[model samples]
Target: MSRSVSRGVVALLLSCALLLTTGACGGGDDKTSASAAEAPTASASFEQQKLAKTRFVANAGLAAGATYQWIVKPYRAGKFKKGADGRTFALVKAGLAGAFTYNRLKAAVNNAKGDPLLSKAVAPLSAGIESLKDLGTKLRKGEAGDADVGAFENIINSVKDAGKSAGAEVVDKVPSASQLGGG
Candidate 1:
């Protein structure tokens, strides 16, 4: 046999082996594979994620008030743009506001080291705020979709609920502290 013909046969055999290995790796439990394939693609569900991010931010900001607005303003102004994706933009804005509010609350809690309850509440509150920031980054990148959005919404709602509970607890603990008091 000619040397060139032998080399061609060897190359063809190697290609077939590679193809078999790849095919075998892909085959798995049919139900699991089908479900995974059926899941919505990221781009298709981007809007939902944006919505969750927005809602969380708004709720957090509302809970925290003025401080939230002040800290998140720059991010909102620079990162968000108006146009077709208005809803998504709004969600991100709200999330940013919430993050800022949470930051202010954390600072206030830190200052009130004498109050352990406030400090404890602030820790989780700070985590919620951080999550909001991460969500915003995802939104900006257009990476998150419906599933992510739903998850984010749940997280924000939880944060809002927690914030409300914490606020009530703080109020009950220190009824006398006026506007002059730390968060």
Candidate 2:
């Protein structure tokens, strides 16, 4: 071979070796690298947190009755299993409640019409949503225990506290008979 051709062959071999070692240029197993690259982004941004908090409060006000319906009614109706070992129903109920709350918050966040406070609330709410999602996954997998429940409760509490901190008041207070009667 000519000297130039020989040098070009050597360069090509070196390039292939580098790609193989670095798992780039398609020379190494792509599955592992692709999965690593494809891992879902889990970090919540500031705007997400703001939106989460705002939506949480709005849902708490707008859907408080629904929350009670889904989480409390079944247990009261005895449709849920009884006994300490039968905590699955309770966990599932709580998970559903959390999921609803998170969904509402996410929607509100996504629908914000450029509100600054809503933007600021998104990150924390996003983190809370991530926690709630993990809790829901655990409940679905039958892997939630007392500790998981406690953690989930804490997350919900934090969301509430964040809402209060953001100056959002509870707008769903019980109305007395006089108020109901338009007195």
Candidate 3:
């Protein structure tokens, strides 16, 4: 198979694995399941709003972690290591992280919509994720530019600040390279 085709397959497989793992790891409580499935209405209870904010913070940390592991750290080191696929694992990880961040953050934003403070805090993040809708494909194609990275970091910082303002402070939790499939 062509390298590009193989890369696509790897990305697809990894994405599927990520979906499966994440889905299987949920709390499985009624409230958690319900919250994950649908956005709460504007009059959602405090518990639901608090849950949404927590989710928002967690996802933001995940995004930052993935980015640091698969993108920024490698770039700073001046070389991207090849994975078992003989392709730069960083690219695949970057692509996956971008998509994952976008999807999860979007869901978190939607869930937080019922709370004015949480909603406003995530507004900039929502807009930022919108601009990164295609980031996965771009990273996979090696077409992503420095501006993309800059924008991503900026968005992360913006969301963390907003979260703190809303009393939902976020902590950076850079994941291990292996955790992100960089190996």
lDDT by residue for model 2 (1-183), tens: 996567656644643343233212112223433343344554434444444445445544432332344334444444344454434444444444444444444444343322355446544566655655555445533465556655544554554554565565434323222221122
Candidate whose lDDT is highest: 3
Estimate the Cα RMSD of every predicted model relative to the unseen true structure. 23.1, 22.7, 6.0
Worst 10 residues of 2 by lDDT: 173-182
What's the C-alpha lDDT at position 74 in model 3? 57
Identify the superior model by lDDT, candidate 1 or candidate 3: 3
Compared with the true structure, the alpha-carbon lDDT of candidate 3 equals: 0.64
Instruction: Give the candidate order by descending lDDT.
Output: 3, 2, 1
- Model 3 bad stretches (over 4 Å): 1-44, 80-87, 175-183
Q: Model 3: per-residue lDDT, tens digit, 3-61?
A: 77887787678765664454322233345637644755544566566777777677667
Best by TM-score: 3
TM match of model 3 to true structure: 0.69
Between candidates 2 and 3, the one scoring higher on lDDT is 3
Clash totals, every prediction:
6, 15, 0
